[model samples]
Target: MIKRLVLLAVFVGGILFTSSSQNIVMDKSNVEFRVANLGANTVKGKFTGMTGNVTFDPKNIAKASFDVCIDATSINTRMKKRDTALKGPKYFDIARYPEICFASKTVSRTGMNYKVIGSLSMHGVKKEVEIIFNSSRNTLTGKLKVNRLDYKIGPKSGVFVGKQVDITITCVVE
Candidate 1:
């Protein structure tokens, strides 16, 4: 009887562990960004479509991983004309690159949060970036800075737009 109870307990523990690291829930998540326009005014926007898988275990940071993608065509800035122009060749060029993606290469715990080192592919360019984030039971919040020129998303000249873009990501996983 004692042996059987121990086996059952072990099995239940294994099931719980596996389930926690498999699927990530993104139903309440958001990906947003901010950049300065030609007149030095801040322009804020968000991508409505996002999908991702995360295998995160706070206890086993070494095995954690993340793969996420955002729809480039879903950019919304509350300005019809500006939004249209962003989808054109001078900006996102959604026709040629419909998705912006990121895949983690490594994950390490920082002071109180964590850092994800990964590859960010956008506008036909792939570059390594570090994202710092904090996670709760099933939610993760993070931010990173990206240079628009690095991804070739816009012209090299900063006359019309700032070179640096600030991005924030909030994701929840089941």
Candidate 2:
């Protein structure tokens, strides 16, 4: 009886540690985006105040996952007027949808990095996206492309802003 109890405890502990949740280093985490304007110039911006829960284990690749969100109102383009405009109805519409969130559905190994297939929710739209990330040390850096038109991100099309947006997400978790 004593041996069976000890074995059960060991198995439970192993299950718990197999996929443990980690805290995001908020100060060191952020999301960046880039969009081409008029086919000539590129407009770049970043969003801060990101928070997330991450469970990652390199040895257990299939068990790793990420659930994260970035404050949409935190968008900064280095121009005050442009930032405010982007927060309005035609762009991010921060008043209604204040958060851009991603929840992992599946994780798979892809070369030296990993591919995270997930649902990206923003601007009241939810879409499946694949984020390929390279883990180094304690940080996870992921990148993906978002279609602005598909997400209803902007009112203007290629005339003023490009349809595709480049996004990069960085997180350091403990």
Candidate 3:
């Protein structure tokens, strides 16, 4: 009889742990990027709109998953001309692909943080990527580097624009 009680308690505890996952708070989240332009000059920008759902439970890391989308048309660099060019065919082509998305397939612990293996889709191209992030309470912060040419984001001869882009993301889960 004592063994049965202990087994029941453990099963209930497992359920409670998994149910602790939360949804992401979009208004409090941010996604931004940095890249180099001509003359080794740097340009920084951000996407103004984002929506996503997050299921995160540190104790149950295997069940955690993230499916997020950012508005491609919301790219802003504080410069009207540059923003316009970024939405054109040579860059994001927002008219054709209006959203950039990431959906996680697996989540695993890495040291004190976590690593998520996921599929990132942008500009009509999809690629597998790894995202490393740290979580504390309801907040998460992470960064990843990607090459623009891998997604056909820019011209093959990117002499004026750098091929590598660094991206950062921060969010609060409710």
Top lDDT hit = 2
Give candidate 1 regions above 4 Å deviation. 1-24
* Model 3 weakest 10-residue run by lDDT: 17-26
> TM-scores of the models, in the given order?
0.87, 0.89, 0.86
As for candidate 1, its clashing pairs are 25-173, 25-174
Residue 158, model 1: lDDT of 82
lDDT of 3 by residue, 10-125 (tens): 99986775566556676788788998888479899998567877888888887789988888999999999999999999999999999999999999999999999999999999
Clashes of each: 2, 0, 0
Per-residue lDDT of 10 in model 2: 96
The C-alpha stretches of model 3 lying farther than 4 A from their native spots are 1-21
lDDT of 1 by residue, 41-117 (tens): 99999986678778887777878888998889989999999999999999999999999998999999999999999
Q: State the local distance difference test value for candidate 3.
A: 0.87
